[model samples]
Each structure stands twice: as C-alpha cells, then as structure tokens.
Target: MLDASGYTVISGPVGSYLAERLAAAIASRNRWNGCVWLRRPQRNLRSLDAALAEACAKRWRADTHPTDDPRRRLERALLGSPEGAVVVVEVTDLTTAIGRLMTGLRPLASDRGVRLVVVAEGLRLPVVRFAPDALVAPAALGGVDGLAARVGLLASAPVAARRLTRLAERRPAVATDLLDAAAVWPHDVLLGALAGRTRTLERVTAALLDLCTPAQRSALETCATTGYWHPQLDTGVVRAADLRPWLVPLEESWSWVRPIWLAPLRRALARRGPSPVVARPAAAGPGSPDDRRLRPPDDRRSRSTGDQGSRSSEDQGSRWTGRGVVEVRLFGGFEVRVDGVVVDFPGRRGRSVLRFLLTRPDRRCPRDQLLEEFWPDVDGRAARNRLQVAVSGLRSALRSATNDHVIEYASGEYRIAPAVRVRTDVEEFEEALGAARSAGRPDVALSAYHQAIDLYRGDFAADVPYESWTLLPRESLRLRYLDALDAAGRIALRTGRIDDCVVTAHRVLEVDPCREDAHRLLMRCYARQGRPHQARRQYELCRRLLAATLSVEPAPETTALYRSIRPR
Candidate 1:
C-alpha cells in the first residue's frame, strides 16, 4: 500500500479510521521482518530506541541481550533478520527527537536490506523536516462511490449510501460512523430522512466537533452560520482546519467537508451563545511581571466539584490581588506569580533554577547538585559561582514582585519558602484526580475527574522540553491525566453521554494504543448504541494491538464482551 523503501509520512486526520485501514493493509502484505508502531513516542531518543529494540526482540524471539545499548541491540536484530526483510515504523506522536532517531537508524536499516517506512500525521515541523520521499494525505475516501463501498453501504442500502457519502464528506471515519448509526435503522426505512433527524445527526456531529480544537470549532461554526468564512479570519485559521482533513476549501471560503455538519453546528452555537474572545497570554520576557494570576492559594476549598463551593467568575480570573498567596503555573508553560502578579526571571538560568527547585519533592536542592544539574559543563568552582548568581537573580526577581521571601537558602540548600502559600496547576490536577477517585458519589467523581483532565493543559515544564530531569515528572503528570480521562470516560459511558465517552476512549487510545480497557470502553459504548458491527470492530482493534505489541491475545473479559456483542 506504500513504498517498500524510504519514508512515507501519512498525514491522516486525527480520530479517524485512516491509521487502522493502513495498518490492516500493511498486515495483509505479511512480508516484514518486524513492524514497530509507536502510538506515542516517549520523551527521549533512548526510550524510543529501547522500544524499537524491544519490538525487534519480541518479533525474532532472539537473544538481543537487554543489557546491550538500544542502538546496538537493534543493529544486531536487523542484521540477523532475513535479507530483503521490510521494517516499518508507524509513529502517531512524532517529536523532533523521534524524527532524528529515524534519520540515524535509516542507514543501518538500509544496509541490512530492511526497508523503513515512517508514518506520521500533521504538517508539524518534525514531519516537514523528516522530508519523506512521499507525503500521503489519507483524508479523502476517494469520493462518494469509494466511501459508499468501503462502508458497505453501496449495494446494501443505496439511498443511505448516497446521503451518508455526502454526510461523510469523503472522510472515512465519518463514513464508518454514519454506517453504524444507519445500521440501527430497519432495512425498509434505510432510505428514510437521516439529515432531518436531529437526534442522529446531532450525535454524529457532536462526535466530529469534539475532534476539533476550540479555535477550529469557532471558525467552522462561523462558516456554517454566516454562509461564508469570517472575513476577519486569516489563512492560518482556514489552514488550521484544513490540516484536520474534515474541512475543504469552497470558493474563497472554507466549508465543512461534510455538509451535514451545518445544522448541528448551528444548534451547538445556539446553546453556546456568543463565543467569547479571549486574549492570548503575552509571552513572558526577562524580568517581566505577569499581570494576572491563576487562582488564590488558600481558595483550595472552592473546588469546581460543586456549584455552591465553586469559584465565581472573578475568583477564577486574577481576582485576589493581595500579598498572601503565590501561584505557579507549570502545565503548558512555566510561570510564577506573587500576590497575583507575574514574576519575571532575571535570565534563563534563573528561571531554570526556580523550576528545578519547584519540581523537587521537598522543593529544595543541595547547592552542589544544582550546580551539577544546571551548569554541568562549567568547572566546579565556576559552576558554584554561576549557581549562586542564578539563585540570587531568582530571589531578586521574586522579591521585586512581593515582600514575601518565596525562595530560601539554608544548610547548603535552596528551597521554596515553607511560609509561602504556593499553588500550582500540577498540584491542583493531582488533587482533583484524587478527589475523583475517592468521591462518594458518581456525579462528584465525574465532575472532579473532568476537572482534573481539564487542568492538564499540556505536559509538565513544556518550555524546557529537552531537559533530562523534566522527563520523569512530565511522563508522571501525563499518565495521571490519562488516568483521569479514563475515569471520566467510564462515568460518561454509564451516564449515557455517548459522545463524551467515545471522545475520551479515542483520546486514551491515541496516547496509549495498548490500553485494552479503553478499547473495551469504546466497544461497550458502540454496543449500547446498537452499533454491533462497530463494537466488534473495536474488539478486533484491541486484539490487533495486543497481539502486535505484547504478543498476547485479548483478555478473557474482552473476548467475552466481544462474544456477547457479536451477531449470533
């Protein structure tokens, strides 16, 4: 289905069946040494290399020696495989490190006569830089006939096929969904009005919209309601949606690839009322104080779980502009605020120094260790001097914002002041996760879990992407976020929030394809919605993933669930 050699980047739409289709095609070929699919690349190159090595070992069942370096192990595995063997690597979350890793492994792979194919999504910098020989867009379903045939709607239900083909907008995932929804209809009424049915249309539309970002959703809603793209919008806005494979250019404007989205989009917009214009937070410069704070440190009791104790609009924003609390935002980016004012670090090292201390368990680090971590290249004496300067600058920056001593130095160590009331998004997210798991009521648990999921904007200390020390904490927080999402998804499934349940299950699978429980949730969700075929398909996916990654079959429970839902 793809080139036998070199890299082929597949810019498939997110939350679509494109990857699964491609995987199936590759499996049919059955002529590979080993195909390693990394659904989400770990933090560093070594971890990714280890995954590749592990996959190779499992495939060959050879003694690749776990103690050997990953690259060495992979080299041995590739050489030992039969000549002309094909090795494909399909990575969903492509990072710059993964791109470089593939580039480094390409020559060795080629020398061993093992073909390499790298599949990725989006036009992100890493994808562009990989410079694959061929870039394939797997968005279009080859027009109406192709989509109809693929979804098994062409001959089985012609009228339904035509309507659904248009509704799918040439997107395979949407076509699959429409097919599943239509499966519930009686054969005689398969041609009945589908677009006019608000319930069915709303269900599919909501699922599709959930795939889009808030910005993309707003742009699409404007195009749907106004009959033209927003004049004020730039090409970036249109291009943004274009990247997703669901929107197409229509004349000078962008329109939904699937026309059926219009009514549902309008209905959703009506419920949302006016879309509020939120200003982007200004980029923090050296020593620049942030104008707004995240939340008050002592406002811990006013959680989002209940309406009575929930924070008001003012409190949610920079409401408390006093000297009692310090807020540290460390999810997407790093920022520190004292008394509701953003504190600017004196320099990069100063910021890193503060981040290093803040991330530690005790919020303290020995001076010597700090010097080793932050100034390892410098001579010991000079590194010590640099650490002192960095700490001094950080302390000076904090003092400028408030009278409180946010950083303290004592006993050859520097730490965040015990007296300073510090609150961070990471802490809050974990708190909410704990609350959700321990909550007495389902509703409370659901609310808390959702809140925790929302609080995780991105990975921990995102600005310091390549820092070795950040990886553990970043992965830890990410796993926690996924846990919260899984918990919330189960709740939504129980409460009959099918759209939310489906969305969460897909999200979990995206980050961790081997998650059988998430796959089971999706299967159960489809079964409850009367889409038995989709439920069975989800089981097949689960089976495939488990077999490929772990060389194991589906768990007994998963198999039982599939059997129950299968056509008897």
Candidate 2:
C-alpha cells in the first residue's frame, strides 16, 4: 500500500506498541525506501527507535532534524521527502494526531492514491473522518475468540464477516506473490508471465471444447509465442503450442534483448577493476586543533586558475602599490593592501556590498535581488537608493587603490570585474582544506588547515540577517567548517597529537556546544594527553547540554568513549 501510494500517518500514545507493529508490517512488506518520521522525543531507544536504528544500519539513509513541535516537524518531513517517497509519521496521542489529520487532509486528498494509516490503543472509530481502505485492530491478535468479538463490533453483516474472514486467511500469500511479482518486472509483464506459466493443454482444450469465447489466457499464449511483451500487444486467441514458433522470430528482432542481457555482465566486469583510493595527509600536532576550529569553511575557497594583474603604482589614482600589485586579504578581517599599506573601504553597507560581490567575483547579481537581500525591510525606493549609495561608495573606495574599476555595473546587473585581485580569507581557507584533503603528508594538510582556520574572523557576512540570499550559503559554510575541524581533530588524535586535538575540539564546542563528535574526540584527546579530569569534565558537559536542549542522552558511542577515558 505504501509503495502504491506516497505517504502514510501512524498515530497513537507513546510506548503504545503501534509504531513497532506498523514499522514491522512496513518492513515485512519490504518498503525499504520508505522514511519513518519519529515525533515523540521521550520514545527514543524504545522498540520503535530500535526498529528505526536497525533499518538505518541495513543501508537505509536516515536524517534527523530535531524539532520541539511534532506538527511542525511533520510539515518539514513532508516538504523534505523526495516526490513519490513513502512517509510514515508517528504521533503520540489521538487528539493531537486528529488535529494533524484535519490540517493534512487537503494535501493528502489531492493525491487520491496516497495511503494514510492511523494506529491507536483502541480500534474505536476515530471522530476525525478518514475512511481508511483497510483497518487492523490489535485486539484481534489475541485468538480466534478475540478476533470474532472484534469482527462483531464492525457493522458488517454475518455473511460479509464470513467472506472477509475467508479472504483474510487467503490474502497473505497472495499479497506476498504480488509483491514478488512487482519486484521482478512491470505489472503487465507479471500478468503476462503468470498467464503463460499457468496455461496448459487441458485448460486450453477445455476452453475450446466448452465453446466459450477466448479469454485473456489465449492472448497471453499468443504474446508469449510472438515475444511481444509490450502492453500494446493484440489480445487474440492462439493455441499454446503455436506460441513457441511465433516467439522464435520475434525474440531475434527485439531491440532491447541484447543490452538487457549484457548489463549485469558489463557491471561485473567494471567491478573487477581495482577501486581508486585517495591518500590523505598525516595528522597534525596538538596545536592543529585551534587552527582547524579557527578556519573558515572550505567550500568558499579560491578557484582562480590564472594570475591577476596587481594594482599599478604609476597612477596617482592608485591608493598604494608595490610590485605593481594590490593584495586584498579576506582572512580574519577584510583588508586591501597596496604595497603593504591598507586601503580603507568606507561605510558598513559599502563593505558588505564589496564583500558580497568579491565572494563570488564576476558573477552578476540583479539590482532588485541585491536590494532585496541587503535591505529587505526597506521600501523599494529607499532600498534602491541605499544600494546605489553602497555601490558608489564601494567604487570610490576601489578607485583609491587602482585605476581599474573593481566593481562593474552593466546589463542591469552588478559584479566584481575579473581584473580585480580580490584575496578572500574564506577562499584561502577552502584552498588550504582542499590541499589538506589531497596532501600526501598529514602534517602538511594539518598545517594548511590551520592556516585556513586563522583566516576566519567570524560568521560569514555576520550581522546580515536582512540578506536572505546569503543565509543558506552562510549556514552551509558554517557546518562544513565545523565538519572539517572534526575531521582534522580526529586525524590529529590518531597521529598522537592529543593536545592539538583537544584544542581543536574545544574550539568546535565553543561554536556549537551540542556537537557530540567533537566532544567525544576531545575526551579521547584529553585521555591520551593524560588529562583524565578534563576528559570527565567534557563528558559531563555533553551530558548536561544534550539533556537540557534535546531532552536526550548522549549516544552509546559517546558514552563508551567517556568510559574508556575514565581513570582506573
């Protein structure tokens, strides 16, 4: 049912056993790709949690976006799932669940084919009006007597009850077969194959002798003989014996037969080749941790493939120049230096505008888009005027250092000109990270990563909430930076640079205290560094923060790390 549809909702009290039963039923049905939405925070590590954990360990991808409200989480889950993917949501109470039902009904109703399953303690008809195609009452699981009693509660007449009982008894195997058939090929092929496999001389003769019109079975025999498995094939009567000869000519002419047979062989041959492996650099010393935490995210690293001309010293318009170049450094803080003398860029908005353009130099940003981002709450006219002023100030600032126009306004768009030598700390950080990722020496990679961290001043484009355009990239870069730090810290610990790992992990915790991996890594680092007390402290802090914020305990892996570090 879930596979045929795209969504399902399961609601019941916490620890009510319904979630596990439903999950087991879904898994037994083999809907491997369906996602189960975990709503109740208190129910973690219970039967349902264990079931989900097992499911994920079996190669299913799972992502958790912790939220306080079940309703909001449900909305986000629905929005996030890829189109046509099954969604199983667990709700704790009938009242709250029914509220969600009403809100979600419109969207679910629009997709008439999607399935909705609601589970609760009792099979009492829900006041919320959703007529499910099938209902399973848990009380029926007791025995034949219990099942009879539950069946009696339904309004179905005695005749219908007996019919349903018989059908229910026969349905499981048929459902299994149908699932198996669905797995093998398209529905039409399954139908054709089943028909062909069942056709016999006795059945054919019986139909012919009975003077009955040829059934779909005859057409299946014709198709099997003709090798025409397509749904568009003519449905005409043909003897089963005649099919083999007709199929011979058609099989040879079919275009897809060769490729279909060759695919697995081709894949097998491809797998025989040696897998390519990337060699990473050695880990850094203890100091490396601070460096990794301090660095900007690696994605914003510079990708300039060519050398740019430096700011020229000959022109009086040049701000300051040496070696015919002006170097703009973006690490830690934004700075443009000509011959080592810093050129001052005026105004906050001007600086922001310049930084925004320089971040993705040469990429055009439409005027309206820029205005909306940089000053979203301001009126259109006021925003445009502010943008104009910012741009003018930025241009004037650039003019102080060089004859070249750094920022260009053209074709109803704004962009930094290619010739401007813009050196960004974020770009440098990313480049270092890339080098580290590719380095043959872990120490070298660690050093590069450290340098990258030194370049980060604060959050990317900090104090720019009005700029909605930058929020996604900003958050993405922030997470990447944190991940890279964790990776570097792990490498440091592995290489016996315990002090460095400790510092690095601590830096990460400063930015995000809830990072369990960083906490665990730091604990290990402290243990190796002979600071058992510090390790214990880190564990305690993690326990406190996780409990307070998420209302959950640290994962077993984290607990194990702490136990390993505790003094004997």
Please identify model 1 stretches exceeding 4 Å from their true place. Answer: 1-310, 313-320, 339-347, 396-404
Please give, for residues 1-568, the per-residue lDDT of candidate 1 as tens digits: 4544555556655334445545655553345435655555565888878887777777767578778999888877776766445555555455567667767777777677666665543222322455455544422234445445544445655555556766655334555545543444333333444434346556545555554455555555445533333222322223323323333333333332334445666676556543322222322331111111111110111111111113333444453355647778788667787776667786988888888888788899998889888888999889988887887888888888887788888999999889777788788788878887899977678767756764665678889899888999899888887787788788888877776688678767767888889989999898888889778877887887789999999999999999999653
lDDT per prediction? 0.61, 0.48
Residue 380, candidate 2: Cα error in Å is: 6.2
Worst 10 residues of 2 by lDDT: 303-312
- Candidate with maximal lDDT: 1
Residues 1-568 of candidate 2 have per-residue lDDT tens digits of 3433323344332123455456655653334354444443233323333443333233234343554244443434444444334444344334433433534543742353324444443333334433343232221211223333432222334443343334223232222222222333343333332233232222222333223222323333223222232211221223223222112121222211111112332233233321111111222432222223222111122211000111112331332333335555543255666444456776987877766776664556778778876788999899989999998887787677666776788888898676654455567668867877897877667766655554454567665655565677678778878877787787787787765576577668867888999988877777777878767867887998899889999999999888877674
- Candidate 2 residue 277 C-alpha distance from true site, Å: 40
